[model samples]
Target: MNFANACRLTLLAAIWGASFLFLRLAVPSLGPIWTISARIGLAAVFLALVAQALKQGFAWQHWREYLILGIFNTALPFLAYGFAARTLNASMMSILNATAPIWGAVIMALIIRKMPTFKVCLGLLIGILGVAILVGFDRVVSQTGAALGIATCLSATLCYGIASAYTKLKASHIPSFQVAHGSMWGASLFLLPLFATSQPISTPTPVVWLAIAGLAILCTGAAYLLYFRLVREIGAASTLTVTFLIPVFGILWGTLFLGEHIGSNTLIGALIILLGTALVTGFNPLASRK
Candidate 1:
């Protein structure tokens, strides 16, 4: 990779990694429903403006697929992560997010009605072990809702896996930018009624507003643009390397900004989980060139 593309990849990872930090900061004050609703809603607006600027148009005929993608990819997972952010630290949540591709492999296998190969099976076992280690040893388990929080985070990743499979099965023909743009709007609409009824736990301060803007604009909207661009420029397999880098930035942001502690267990579990993800996805930077 050239230096410019490498820089874009790193920047994308840093932006996505900071999303957890923003969720943790905003969710307590905004509540999960309101926080996620605002996030997708604002992100939709941002992407719409970008689309207009680029003279891009939507595929209105594919609205149904967009809604399904929105539900699984944007609304459900984002809401789950928002809820998880209430009790889990940003570091742990980011690490758990890495499990999405592992879940994807299993889901795709079931979709195809085929048994997983030995390598995938081994990856699945190791992935589960990593989660066990991370949750079993983390001090956050002492918190009241931490168990549910971890489960919620896992469910979010499962939603991501489902979305990936669905996209491959039914929506792969749509351009990535169109899918992203349309789904954000779909998610915003899906969450509208709930957002209307929900109230924030407390009045949001400027910090919360800033966090929401960063989450919606940078993390959701701009990150999608960068992601699709990298896919076009470098190919999707190479772009997947961002998955391995996200947790590093997640841990760094949490420690430096949120003052979250990183135990030995966190490092070990992260390494194991990443290893399993690499195995399951067959992601290799060197091989991607072939």
Candidate 2:
């Protein structure tokens, strides 16, 4: 890629990384389900307007696929991350989220009937080891909630992995922006009942509303636009690099703005996770074999 595109990619990464911070800020005021629903719903609106203005052909041609994508790509993962952030630091949650691509490769191999390459196998091993270390540290310190939060993040990432694979194989034909809009609409539908039952409106504050606005406009809407553009320009692997950068930006932002510490083990694990992901996603042994 050229220098401009590289900078754009980095900016996209920063936007996504900042999302963890915003989620941390927003979730405390607005509960997880409602927050996710609102932001994604707003994002959908933005996408809808853009699509209409552009005269883009739009339809939920495959309702089932859109539903599945909504669940895997946005609904499940978004809720998981939002809920987990209540218990875990954004730094920790973002670090754990870097596992999405690792899980995605495995899911792709299984569902698509492609065999797992050595790089993917190695990445799986490394990722598990890194997670075990995090869990072990938490267990020894009696921070069980943090461990569970990380596990929640992993579950979300697993969904992301499956969704990533599925999107690349099945939804590539659709414009990425349209896919984003459709997924957001589906997610909004799934989340509406939960938001109402959870009774978030009764509990929300002005700060919460402001947080929701930033989360919707800056993080979800703008970030997704950049993300879709990056994926179309550079393909999925390059797009997924934002996964690694998110944690770094999360930790830095948390430290700077929230007075959170950068623990040694967290840094070490982050490095290992990134290295493993790079090995898995950046190089394909199958391609070389072919």
Best by TM-score: 1
At residue 242, candidate 2 shows an lDDT of: 72
Which is the leading candidate under lDDT? 1
lDDT score at residue 148, model 2, on the 0-100 scale? 64
Measured with C-alpha atoms, the lDDT of residue 272 in candidate 2 is 81
Encode model 2's per-residue lDDT on 1-290: one tens digit a residue: 55766777778777777778878888877778878988888877887887788787667686666777888999999999988877787777778888888888888888869878787788888888777665555422355566667778889999998898888888877777777778888888888888778846357777667767877877787788888787777766566667767887888877887677676677877878877777777645344222
lDDT at residue 191 of model 1 (Cα atoms): 95
Model 1, residue 51: distance off in Å is 0.7
Q: Against the true structure, what is each candidate's TM-score?
A: 0.98, 0.90
User: What's the residue-level lDDT of 87 in candidate 2?
Assistant: 78
Q: Please list the residue runs of candidate 2 whose C-alpha ends up more than 4 Å from where it truly belongs after superposition.
A: 138-141, 201-206, 283-290
CA lDDT, every model vs. true structure: 0.95, 0.77
